[model samples]
Target: MCSRYVGFILLVWFPGALHAQSAARHCPAPALVGGYFVPVKETYSHDFQLTYACENTYKPAVEGWWATSVCQDGTWSHTPQCIDEKGCFPPTIANGKYTHASDGWYEEESVIRITCDKGYEHKNNLATAKCANGTWSSLPTCEQSIKTCSMPPKVPHAVIVHQGYLELFPEDSKVHYECKDGYRMEGSDKNPIVCLAGTWTEYPTCSKVTVRGDHTSTERGTQPGSGGGGGSRPDSGHVSVEVGTGRGHSTSSGPGTQPGSGGYPSTSDTRPIMIPIKDCGTWPLVPNGVVVVQDRMFLKFTCNAFYTQVGPEDVVCYNDGSWSQIPICKDAFCVMVPGYYTYGLRLSENQFIKEGELTYIPCEWNDYSVAVRCTDRRITHTSCCRSYDHQWKRCSIVRENFLPVGSLIKK
Candidate 1:
C-alpha cells in the first residue's frame, strides 16, 4: 500500500512540471533597421530587455541614440526603427542673425538668410547658409566694412613690381608684373592687374620663348666659260641651304661643269612647316546628357536638370585618340508634378524628391494609396493601402504617366 501511494504522487508531480515548462514563452530576435542591438540572441525569454543603438546620421524612431525594448508575449514591446537624421543645426554667426525662424530642425537643402548687426557686414557678401546632408555648408561671417586683398599670387617667371614692403592691398589697387629675362608677358600690357572687390582679376602669364634652331650660312658660286679662251667667272648660282644650329657653308659650280649651262640652283626662301592639330574626335556621347566641348582637347559633361553626373566633370582627350574618362549621367531626383499630392503634403509647384525616399500616391478617385520608391531614377510601386474611411482621395502623382509599376524611367 505505501509503495503504490508514492508512485501515484510522483506521476502527478511529473506531469504538472512538464505542463509548466511548456507554458513559458519566448520572443524571436528583433530586426532593427539602420541600427543594431547588443547581446544578440536567437530568442529571448519573456520580459527580456535589450539595448539598441543607431548608426551615424540615423536616429532611433523613439528619442535618443540608445534605446531599450522588452520582449513580451512572443513579441517585442517596441518596434525598432532608425530614421535618417536629415538636416543640420542652425548656424551660429558672431554678429549675424538668420532671418528664418524655426522650432525644429531645418530640412535638407533649405537656405537660411542672414542679416548682420549694425556697423558690420558679411564678408564676401555671403549672407546665406545652406543645409546639405546633415551639416551647414557655411556660416556667414560679419566684419567691419573693409575690403582688402592679401598678397597677390606668385606668378611663374614673373615678380610683382612693388615699391616698398606691403602686406595688404586695398580694393581697386593696381599691381604690375615684370616678366623675367627670356620670357615675355602673354596677356595685354595695357591693362594693369587690379584688385577689385577684395579679389584680384586675371593675372598675366610670363611665357618663355621657344627657339628650335639658329643657323648662319655663306655661299660662293663659280662659272666656267665654254670656249678654250673662256675662263672661270663668278656666277650668281643658287645654293641648296641646309639649316642647322651651328654655322653652315654652301658652294655651287657652274652648270657647264655638269654638261648643262644653267645658273646656280635658285635661292629658296625658308618656310616653316605647318603641323595639324591633334584631335581626339568629337566629344564622347554621354547617355541622358550632352557633352560641352570646352576646347578641342577638353570637354565638360553636363547632365539634365534632375540628373547627376558620375565620374569626372572635366575630361581630356588624350594624344592617343581616347578620352581620359567617360562620365555617366544618372537620374538623381524624382519629380512630383503639380495637382498630384501626397497625404498631408501640399505642393504649389513641382517638387523634386530625392532617391531612397518613400512616396505615397493616392489612387485615382479612391481612398486607397499606392506606395512607391525611387531607386536609381526608377520608380517602383511597393504596396497599396486604403484609407480608414475608404472615401475618394487624390494623391500626388509622379511626373510621367504610362510608366508601368516597377518599370525604370529613362530620362
Candidate 2:
C-alpha cells in the first residue's frame, strides 16, 4: 500500500514512470550522450526538460533531493523516481552564440567587415565576421597616396636649346628656349612645364633664319655738269690699273684733256670706274650687317680697322672721279686664310678653333685638301685659310705658299 500511494502520486505528476522503483537516480529521458555540452551556466532546454513533484510528497531540486516524479514523463513507469541533471556547465563563448560545427571541422575564419582610418584608404578586400572556433580575428589594412606630372613639346620658327643636354629630372631639368639671335618668339607669354612619372618638361624651338637682301647697279657716263671745272672723268681718258699685276697697269691710254693740278686725270677724257668692294672673300659675313656696299671700291685700307669713306685708310673717287687705289675687306680685319689646323680640321667663322677643328682655304673644294697656315686664300692641297678672330686679321699669313715668295697675286 505504501508503494501504491507513491505510484499514484508519481503518475499524477510524471504522468508515467520508466522504473517501477520507489526512487531512481536518473530520469528515462532520451538524449545524445557525450555528444553535446551545455555551457557551465546554461540550463537544459526547458521545452526538452521538466521538473515535477508528486502530490504525495513535497520535494526540492536544490536540496540534493529529487522525487520519483523527476523521471522523464513518457519513459518512466507508473512508479516515481528521482535523478540529478548533469552537464549544465557554462561554455567558452560568452556572447550567447552557437558554435555547433557538427563535422568536427571548424571554420578557419569568419567574414569580417573592415574599414580604414581618417587619412588612410582601404587596401585589402573587406569581408564579414562569422562564427568560428568560438571567436573573431583581425581586420584588413589601408595605405597612403601620391601625385605625378608630364613632358614638354617643341616650338616653331625659333631655335631652342637647353644650352646643355636632354636628360631626365634631377639632371637637365625643365627649361624653355627661344631664338638664338635673330628670331622672335611667338606664343603664350608664360612657358609650360610638367612632370611625367616624376620626369620634367623641357621644350625646344625652331628658328627663323633669313634676311632682306638685294642689289642694283648704277651706270652714269663721266661728264662735267653745270658745276664749273670739277666733274666725273670720261671713259676714254682713264687707264685701267691692276696693282700687284706682274706689270703695273694692265692697260694704258692717252692723258686726259684737263689733268687735275694733282697730276691725276680729270673729267674731259677720263672715266671713273665704280667697282664694288668686298672682303678678300676670306672674311666671315658680318653677323647683323652687310660687310660692304655695292659698286663702291675700297681703294686703300689696313687689315681689320675702322672704315670711313674719307678716312686715311680709305680711297674713293676724287673730284677728278678716279680712285687712288684698290679696296678690299682685308682692310677691315686680320683674316686667317681658311685651312686645316690638324686632323683635316678646316677653318670656319667661329673665333675659337680646337686641334680637331677643320681649317681650309676657300675654293672649289674637290676631294683634295692640304696643310697650311691661316693667311693663304688659295685653294690647293697645300694652301689653307687662317681661322682667327673678330677683326679677321689676328692670324698670320705665309708669304711663301707652294709658289715662290710674292709669286701669287693678292687678288
Candidate 3:
C-alpha cells in the first residue's frame, strides 16, 4: 500500500511541474545583430513592431517594400539595410554653365561650381551651389552684360560731337559739348562728359550772351524824302565809283530831263536802284586803341598804341547778309631783362614798358651812354657820346653783351 501511494503522488506532481515550466517559457524581443535597427532599446517585448527610416542621402537597400519588421516568438521578421540615394540630374543654366564634375553619384553637401558665358557679367565672379537631401540649393543667374552706352543724353542749347561712324559710346570714351551761336557756356570751355561703367557723366549747360554798351546801327545810304542837296547819287555815278562794278544798275529816264551838277541828276531819277544790300549790321565792341575802317562791302580792324592784332583783321559782308570772323587786340609787353644792374639803368614807375616807348642809360659808368626805344615790339639801343675824353681810352658796349662787371675800365 505505501509503494502504490508514493508512485501516484510522484506521477501527478511531476506532470504539473513540467506543464508550468513550459507555460513560463516566453520570447524577450527580436534582435537585429546583422544590420542597423530602428527603435534601438535595451529590452523588447513580444509582438513589437518597428518602422525604419534611412539617414539623409541614404535609402533602403531593397526595392518595393516598406522598411519595417516585427518581433515574434524570439526573432525579427526582416533586417534593414541602407544605400546611397540617387544623385540629382545635371543642372541646366541660361547664359551660364556648371563645371568640375565627378564620376560617382553626388552625396549630401556636395558642391558644384558655376561660370557665366563670355561677354556676360555676374555679381560674383565665380558662383557655387550645394546639394542636400537629393535637392540642389538656389543657383545664381547670368544675364547679358552692359558695358557700353547709347547716344548720350542731350543738353539744352548744346550739341554732342559724333566721332565719325561710331553708333555707340564705349566705356571711358569722351564726348564734347559745344555752345551754339548767340550763346556761350558759363562754366569752363573744356568741360566734357565721359562714359564710365556703362553710364554717361553729367553734362554742362549753355547760357545766352549778354552784350555791353549802347546798341545802334550806322546809316549807309540817304533816305527818300530828305530835302537836303546831299541826296543819294545815281546808280552809275556813285555805285560804280564805290563798288567798282556796273553789273547791278537798272536805268530809266523820264520824259522831262533835268541834268544835275557833276554829271549826276539834279532831280530824282525814276529808275529803281538794284543795289545788292551787303550789310554786316552793327559792329561788335572794339578793344581799346583799335581803329575800324569800313568800305562799301568790307570792314578792316587795326590796333594802335603798342597793341598787336590777333585773328582775322579783314571782314567782308556777303550778299546773303553775313560777316566774317572778328578779331581782338592784344597788348604788347617787353621780355624780362637778362642782367642785374647796380646803377646807370633807370625805369619809370611802370615795371613793364610798351612798344615805341623810350628808355635811357646814364653815362655814370662810361663816357658813352645808350638811348633805347621799343620798335616792332623789340628794344633798339643807340650809343651816344656824353663827352670826348682824349686821356682815357674809349670803349664801346654792345646791347647783346650787357652784363655786370667789377670795373668798366682798368687804368
lDDT of 2 by residue, 42-108 (tens): 2222223343342222222222333222234234332232222321111233212333433322333
**Per-residue lDDT of candidate 1, residues 149-219 (tens digit):** 55555555678776454656656778888878866676656336775534456666665554546842211
**What's each prediction's TM-score?**
0.23, 0.16, 0.23
lDDT of 2: 0.31
Which residues of candidate 2, in runs, are more than 4 Å off? 1-222, 225-312, 328-411
Model 1 lDDT at residue 379: 55
- The stretch of ten residues in a row with the least summed lDDT in candidate 1 is 219-228
After superposing all C-alphas onto the true structure, candidate 2 shows an RMSD in angstroms of 39.1
Clash pairs of candidate 1? Answer: 237-264, 238-264, 238-265, 340-396, 341-395, 341-396
Report every candidate's CA lDDT: 0.54, 0.31, 0.47
User: On a 0 to 100 scale, what is the lDDT of residue 171 in model 3?
Assistant: 58
